[model samples]
Target chain A: MNRPKEIFMMTFPLILLLGVLSCLYLESCSAKKEIQLIDSEPYPIEIPKGFPDIKIPEGNELTKARVALGKKLFFDPILSVDSSLSCGSCHLQKNAFTDLRTTSIGVEGRVGPRNTPSLVNVAFNPYFFFEGGSPSLEAQSLGPIETFHEMDFNAALLTKRLAADEHYQKMAQEAYGMEMKLFVIVSALASFERTLISANSPYDRAINGDSSAMTPAQWRGKELFFSDHTNCASCHPAPLFTNFSIENIGLEKEYQDKGRYRVTLKNEDIGKFKTPGLRNIGLTAPYMHDGSLESLDMVIEHFNVGGLGHKNQHPLIRPLDLSDHQKKDLIAFLHALTDQDVLLKPEWAP
Target chain B: MKTIKVILMALIGLTMLTLQGCDNSGCTDPDSLNFDPEATEDNGKCDFPNLTVNFSYSVDGQELTKGTTYTINGTAISFSDVQFYVFNPRVAKDGVMEATGETHFISFDNRSIEFEDLTAGHKHMLMFGLGVDSTTNATIQPSDSDLADGAALGPQNPSMHWGWDNGYIFLKMDGMVDTDGDNVPNAGMEFHIGKNINFNTIALEIHTDALEDEVEVTVDVDFAKAFTGIDLSKDYITHTGDFPALANTVINNMKTAFAKK
Candidate 1:
């Protein structure tokens, strides 16, 4: 007994059940793969070469049943009020889950304030939306549908709408047991979005010691990008190609639409927006929060001049004064970030 | 032979220990809805109930019984519509919860709202939020369980949701009230309150009766009480995000607006 007491100092702490711990515990218990809603195996979320472990939220665990249900819901237009659009209508797989439109159109031909965001590698994001308001994929899922310009659907009616469908009813019973609820619907959708992994790009391979994966011009551009003078890598970090921190980047002298400030309500965060990952960046355009820039050339030119130098702009953002040839090299590197295989994934497409 | 016999005995001991740990397992989480006391291990079988509490729109503790006008402060206030959202109910002792309640939407037309299921041995004191909390307001989704009931043969409509802000309007009181002590009702009292900042909480003690499953605990909202010390002859129309500060007087008066009957 005396020995046990003495050794207590050297021993590990006892496991305590805590509310804070629950929020960080992302994955569900990986039980033996037992089929429920579908005849499918548990989809293992693939961790890319350099990315950290993906933590699915505590309440939501990615199971085969949930993902299958989510896939059906993602493609279904029934989530919309008028049934004129679906999530797939704007977030097309070919464009790497972005509406190629300058800004997405809404119900009754209304134009929205912001651009339709790309969902590629969205699971890896620390926060959701252009302003980085929602912390989880599940939390961000409800935003567009409630927006008058988007699907314009009330969340309360989802249970009735989903319950009416025989396919959804059977699936709901098999996956969650009992009838359809709002929690089940969003959890399923968030799980399906988690399955969208885009790690097969040539740049990813090149970074992982495959010198032949990328062209020589792209290689030269990579040097300038990571170099201190260019100052791209400081914000657009490696692996996911985004540090996931909010920045102003001097988009305007004064913002017509305040970005991160809308969420945070702080003056310093006024024009700040999330640093979007560079993966599949080429496919998803026009760029920026308003989608004001049309092409890679325009984005490069903006950076070359180091933006308009707004007050809160990052210290690293300054005029590179790059020559025409160097700008082309950088644009070529961005194009190499594209992964063609993501577009061909049948399960992701409608 | 001796070595093998000793090994078999050790294996058997380990098996018995494992079996003993697994026996009569149940939900051990204190926060879980189906918490069991005699459980040796947790089996993750936690299920919370949908406890539906109710409300009765009244005038000075007297039931108006629909379209009934009541005279107070020398004005005739007739309410055409009266509704609000309540969230995160809890049974408390001195302010600590004995059980948790679900978020609900209630109105005069449909006064009943089912909350989360209770386990056992909870008392009369209750606590609930007048509107959606900051976290819920920011992260609301369509399939959110907090919604009272998705409207199907029910009056819990989604129109109460603020389509622009992505949050539900916490309270809406639309009626005509005579502000100048005139016999005729003239002023349109459109006081719809929402947004996370304006959300308030109420800690109530149900002194009238003991708590039971599905028992009605009436919370009163008096239009007369809102006009106790102020004139409502002004425009009084509060929008979703604009002028929440202007509606503070009406919102603060709601602290005394609810009482156990």
Candidate 2:
């Protein structure tokens, strides 16, 4: 063969091989990497009548996959530092998502400072915690995960741990279209929590044209609750049963725990706390911010006698001098607030 | 064998000629550790040298540590934990401020702060906030992409970030004081100072020196100054908002505490 043909013979196979390899690499680069979702059904939240529309963050829309992922993580101990506690440990479904303990118990028996609030109707809350510190549910989820007495786990480490599991990776991808990241973890959890709407109570039913739903005693208690004598409706109004105002209800004479003051640092906010929704108040026993009041009876008595009259106490919180029978009626009315369906809802459970 | 050698030589020549036509891809920043002066192209992987700042706490000329006892104003006191947040570091040359927008969480354990992006310069003034800046303090959730794991704004163990308030505790000095004359710290004393109003800017004029590419500076923090004019025995607790006067005093004292060593 001629010299040119000999060179061509030597380099043709090499050139073809290089071309094939380059095409393969280019194909890999140009191909759109589609994430295989486990399930991505859009979850439309069923807002009850009289309940305000939940404002979900634009980035985090409700999805079945996202809520499912959050529900799984909420009940899983993998987020804890010791892998011994989960959000479910403190917020049980039977207790309207409250732990029933005076204060919450964390991983390794570490005691939390505040009582576990019910997750029901939490999506309606403008801010989180009794102090109203956190601005959003996404931000509030970080509190339990990082608090020393709670999960005591680092988000970086938790993500790293979750990333190791293929199942978690797939779930995270399905939920967030991303790996198991800090944002995904918090956002997913918030999505699930926002879906925990508890509006199907006896009071809710009675107000919605079902007059037989509420008993006569509960109806009487409702009248007193809305009446000017108690002024309960001032802070805790109807429908949601909470005005969502931060107030000093005169829980103590000298406040041991500075409630809203911790958030705002205002002198007037020193002994103030967010007025929690009365919905599910019956199942969420051991009431008050610190769970100081053990039952609905104790809560009514505290309110009836008027709070200890702290310097910054709300003027509306005064001695009602409610009769024992009136107190019982109020307690019975509170029991009517419990939504039996939400308590046993399989979607909320582990 | 001769034909194979000829082909290998041709391939080697082709490789060298091809390399001459292409630009070398590498980090071109002079301040970076892997800076390539000859590179004509940047691959965007620049490994900048860390500018380290070592903060050593002292109380009355003695090295301060957890459980380190000191007598102040005829009262004995000892600390269990002391932590603070440092952010918005800047090195100035003749009045021009060079800002390194970074925040750091400082405790007794992690006192050596490393700034990866601070460029080398002959800086006469070193300024940093004793607490997080208002913009960062306003960030309730520190999981933002910019706020990394060790960032002062991010979550920490023995958390400086208040989950309740959604703000960082600028300076936390938790300890106990001897109230009953036993010469032992028995009563709890805590100064959890934090808030947007309490963020203090600490500016120090150091001797004119050329800060090397990878410089290390030692700063002495006299924590004893943090308790000046305060009765440690009685005024033991201040969570900034709860006790604004005490918090302001501590913050003002801390502003004067840091000095270049």
Candidate 3:
């Protein structure tokens, strides 16, 4: 046993070497890979070269995952109290994101007070609600969710349900990474909605110098729409087609219902409703807040007579006195506002 | 052997020192610190006096009691509920407006004990008006399914709006009045008061120091007094035949009434 000490020394180095090597191997195995955070696809969100950024909250840039999830959630009736109604129920894809019914039906066969508005180009709308009560798309998302006659789901319950779902968890993580929250869900939906820009309409093409986009009647209608006699352009304007302000438009003197005044509590705002954009006016039929007018011709006739004889009627509303031909031309112009790309999109289909 | 032991001890000591340095600089002990040793926390308590204002009115000869239901003309009318909202109501000591909190939205629904939550004095200016404001009106859409259960007032309940001519019935005053010879059974009037873009407002003031417990105040709004300047005999009719004419007359009438109050 003369070499016992030497033997121990040799074995010790071997053991230490093996231990260090194993330790290095374990470290290598446990180390995480670098996350490849790909930048989301850039959209044409940039305003025209000279135009200022609209003084509104910028919606988050759209992502494929978020848009996909939003589309799913939009079509899912699970958001309703009874799981019977979805956003798509009221905003059908066939009618360019508007329902044909006069008023939308909600949960438990409940009826809403106003006509279901179209969602096309809703991102460009500065204000929401017929009376412009909510200022942003983010705020508007919660309107149907909380209304007793609509979805009727408690916000807290919705949060808890979403938190529990593994599918939603994955979606949320993909859309927002680690910053996902209930409010972020709303933001993502709004972002997805903003991507629904219908700028490829025939009218847009014609305005952008495509002569073949419009017929002669539609061209004449465009002229009449902007003319002093029609005065439609005063409220409807160009591009997005709305002035984004409240006007009485002479529907009534006193309504049992106050429109915009409900938000402000000001007496002066009585009978005032938000002037809706006329883009895709052909598709979003059963017109007006109450959906009283059935056809485009009826809408023209109503405006022609200066609306109901209410004291608060907008001064801009006067007898158009358009001939039948002019009215048909105006109708044709309205039809040209329809975007084929938007209508045919498979993503929009429920 | 002794040298190896000493070297191992030194290495251990170095490791311990490194750990100590990390603890001091990097890791924080949340339980070690003390917070706010001197200040008393706010427990949301209020100590204020009380006040009351008794309202008495005589129609013809009979003195009106608080809960008495009376038939005006023929339609039954009564003060179902009454409370006051002092827009910018404040607590005051002596003659100065106090910085203390006051109560607001003193209504039949939200009955809070602390009038100080609304205002802080018996000698408070009582500005009052009748009818639901515009903000409250939009919430009550006629087609809203919730309204079917009578949660919101709409056309089915009273048909307040003159069809669609007037968007919504703003104010509803339902009471019978002496018309022609006989007291008309259903002679009632609804003042759907709203204008296009003019803010119509009413104000009234009262000074009170009468109370024993916490100061409680109530303002009496007389519907009869609301139509004081309005001639019931001529302007008041059962049916809203001339909508534009009636609307103009009512708007002017409401503005005058509010201003006077």
Best by DockQ: 2
Q: Write the per-residue lDDT of candidate 2 for residues A73-105, one digit (tens) a residue.
A: 999999899999999989899888998899998
User: In order, what DockQ does each candidate have?
Assistant: 0.14, 0.32, 0.03
Worst 10 residues of 1 chain A by lDDT: A26-35
Model 2, which residues run further than 4 Å from truth? Answer: A1-32, A35-40, B1-54, B62-83, B107-124, B145-152, B173-191, B211-216, B229-247
CA lDDT of each candidate? 0.73, 0.83, 0.59
Predictions ranked by lDDT, top down? 2, 1, 3
Ten-residue stretch with the least lDDT total in model 3 chain B: B26-35
Off by over 4 Å in 3: A1-59, B1-261
User: For residue A154, what is the lDDT in candidate 1?
Assistant: 65
lDDT of 3 by residue, A69-148 (tens): 67777888877777788878888878878888888888988887788888877877777888786656765776676565
**Ranking of all predicted structures according to DockQ, beginning with the best and ending with the worst:** 2, 1, 3
Residues A1-350, model 1: lDDT tens digits: 79887676545343334444664553232221222334334667777877777778765677787888888888888888888878888899988998898999877888987877778788888778877766667766767776668888866676678888888977766566546776777778888999998898889888788989999999988888888879788988887889999999888999977787655556788788889888888898899989989999999998988889888888777899999989999988888899998889988989
Q: How would you class the docking of model 1?
A: incorrect
- TM-scores of all models? 0.66, 0.80, 0.56
Clashes of 2: 0
lDDT of 3: 0.59
Q: Residue by residue across B176-258, what tens digits does model 3's lDDT show? A: 44446344433444444433332233444445552334444543434454444555645563222224345455444543332
Which predicted model would earn the best TM-score? 2
